[model samples]
Target: MTRWLGASEVAARTKSVMKTTLRSGTGRIHFLLRAWRPISSHTSPVDSSDIISAVSPKTLQKGGDNGNFKQDFMKLKQPRSSVTTVLQSGNSEAQRTSITKLRRVVKKLCKSKRFERALEVLMLMETQNKIRMSPADHALRLELTIKVHGLLKAEEHFNQLPNIASQKASSLLLLHGYVKEQNTEKAEAFMAKLKGLGLVVDPHLYNEMMKLYVATSQNEKVPLVIKDMKQNQILRNVLSYNLWMNACSELYGVGSVELVYEEMLSDKNVQVGWSTLSTLAKVYTQAGLVHKAFAALREAEKKLSSGNRLGYFFLITLYATLNDKEGVLRVWTASKAVSDRPTCANYMCILLCLVKLGDINEAEKIFKEWELDCRNYDIRVSNVLLGAYVRNGLLDQAESLHMHTLERGGTPNYKTWEILMEGCVRSQNLDRGINFLNNDFAGLKCHD
Candidate 1:
């Protein structure tokens, strides 16, 4: 007969025994087994009769009157087996749902810029071996790893992937990672390896290679990428042509840009966007082809709707570049008329153009008008006018405006002081300059 100890008595004795066993240099496993064993165990001092008395008749009958009490006690002691059985029954479905939820969470985390947590989720999924990662998933995980832990970790992850995941898309992602790290040699080598593998390299990959070259200021290598694209017979899109034009313009000059432009124009398959036209106009301006620049701008305008601020803004800037006063004013008027609400940027453009053209009186008048309606007072607008005044040797006007701005609780930036100091030196007014440095401009905070 086993005597069943009360719950409190059992707990206290178990704790004491565990402490004693641990201090005696016995292994913890022995204490744990002893502490957790049922009172019916042969080593326990409790009587079996106490346990038998506590058992209901139904339970005794279920175990059978022959009473294998130890077996019944063992069944009561281990509940984990039944719990594990229940857990294992629906495990596959639960695991599938968990994987699905984890993938969704990873995507959302990545979008929210929580890259570390996103990578942790991905690692958990990988360790669990419950989710089947597609090529895109592998690529995304590599990208996230690159962003969070850096390129070395991303490379390790990529290398650990199965051969099936080493497809063209995943390879492209790794190549992009190398490009981001500015490892030109590794990027080129990896790209070449991809080609050697007989992977059908797309135009985007070539574009990425070209972008890498451009970013590195290795402009000479850009045309080589285009040449490769041509040899591969990959059709050049507008983006490709633009990259070629930019590389050519930088290395060879406007003539090369023109040649590329002509080729792009003749290629009926490529649709010319406003960006293409803008690029052409800029290149023409750099080459001093004023009429050509105007023609490109006009064509850009034709493509845009009347209400398009971009077209109006571009027209004003190009005209200002050519010093076409009437054209700038005309385009500005047209923009203001069509725009429901003109932004500060639009007003700044017109003001900057007016100041650059040396129309000080008109700039002042426009500044006054803008001041009345402007919701935000940008110091940049004031700086433009101040710069014009200093350049034209109108130190008196600049000083007056500076003082007025200060009176109105406006803060002058570093450029403003520099301009005033320059004006003082230019005019040979050393005393006024010393005063400015000591008093007016003293303790001025410079913002970057």
Candidate 2:
């Protein structure tokens, strides 16, 4: 029988190896950076087109490339020298690519979810430019490590840091990684260790732990986090109170949740937002307190900013849950007024709301409106109406919508097939239902 190594044990074992490996390979780190280079080994004049393609504002903003972005980044003159030297050289054209420009490119890559490419550029910034890594940068590197590799590799990276025990940011970042992975055991142990390191005084750490507990269905542990915060005299932030309220909502009744809200309101340090009100309204709606739910929702609407479509989404959803068609349409119109055009997500939200209210005609009109203006052919939007039609015993409309989706270049996802199969089974069309299930399995195979 093999025993599994705990997080600490794994960290300890990997630390020495990681340090030794890094030390031995520090000189050749630039080579690792250049592995993505599109050019040959021989030194050639830097092509302006290559430079433009890699770090231009348009390229950075949109993260689009002519199938060569991953391959052609940071035109280097030599392997031994820093990018700083190349940029500072007498070549005025090369001087255009400043350190700031490189940093911007890295930021864009990160925003676009190109972590591997972002890591490569970040390595260039560090090894090639000899830039100092700030605390935020350390946290970023740890996050990147978690993304590219896993929690274990991130642990190894953290362990290799100088004064590893004292660095709060890196420690918290690792804790966040554990939380994100939902490894309750390791997260608990690491959090305990964090407290010993005198880093638990910050409410952010406690908030993260509470969020983890809530996510993992450990609602009972959420109050314990609050108790720990009170004992430590840590001032609760908005997020901290919100998590407590959420946990209360899950584990107790509306009254218990309301008490938490009252306490949050009294806390001068924390300002309640539209999110808290929405959560409260959800609880109220569930409890059949229509008047109270409506009151909370009204307050939540007032708190909404024009640019914050998320609040509108939540509001629209809750209004639908309350069976208010007028409220749903009102919020949907508000959302579109603030933006250039409604996103597929926005259409889905309202479509779901209308469908839930049993307003098939209104939902169909909304679906048609989406079908006309949607840049991307999202089968999900069509599937919402398709599922609605099937649930309402309108199998013909569902079939017609399915055909229309196929004509519009929309590919059927698993949910699409499942919805259609459900309709087929309801109509007693066993042959087509069998075909759908087979097709779904085939799709899975092709995906794999």
Clash totals in order: 8, 0
* Residue pairs with backbone overlap in model 2: none
Query: Which whole-number lDDT from 0 to 100 does residue 351 have in model 1?
Result: 87
Off by over 4 Å in 1: 1-183, 196-200, 212-219, 250-256, 305-316, 329-350, 361-378, 400-412, 427-448
Instruction: For residues 254-349, write the lDDT of model 2, one tens digit per residue.
Output: 889999999999989888889989988998998899999999998998888887688899999999999899999988887875755778888998
Residues 271-366, candidate 1, lDDT per residue (tens digit)? 887668877888888888988988887787656555667767877787788888887887777677665677778778888998878788988987
Ten contiguous residues minimizing lDDT sum, candidate 1: 78-87
Winning candidate number (TM-score): 2
List runs of model 2 lying over 4 Å from the truth: 1-97, 124-129, 163-166, 432-448
Model 2, position 122, has a per-residue lDDT of 58
Q: lDDT score, residue 202, model 1?
A: 69
lDDT of each: 0.67, 0.73
- For the record, the alpha-carbon RMSD of candidate 1 to the native fold, in angstroms, is 22.4
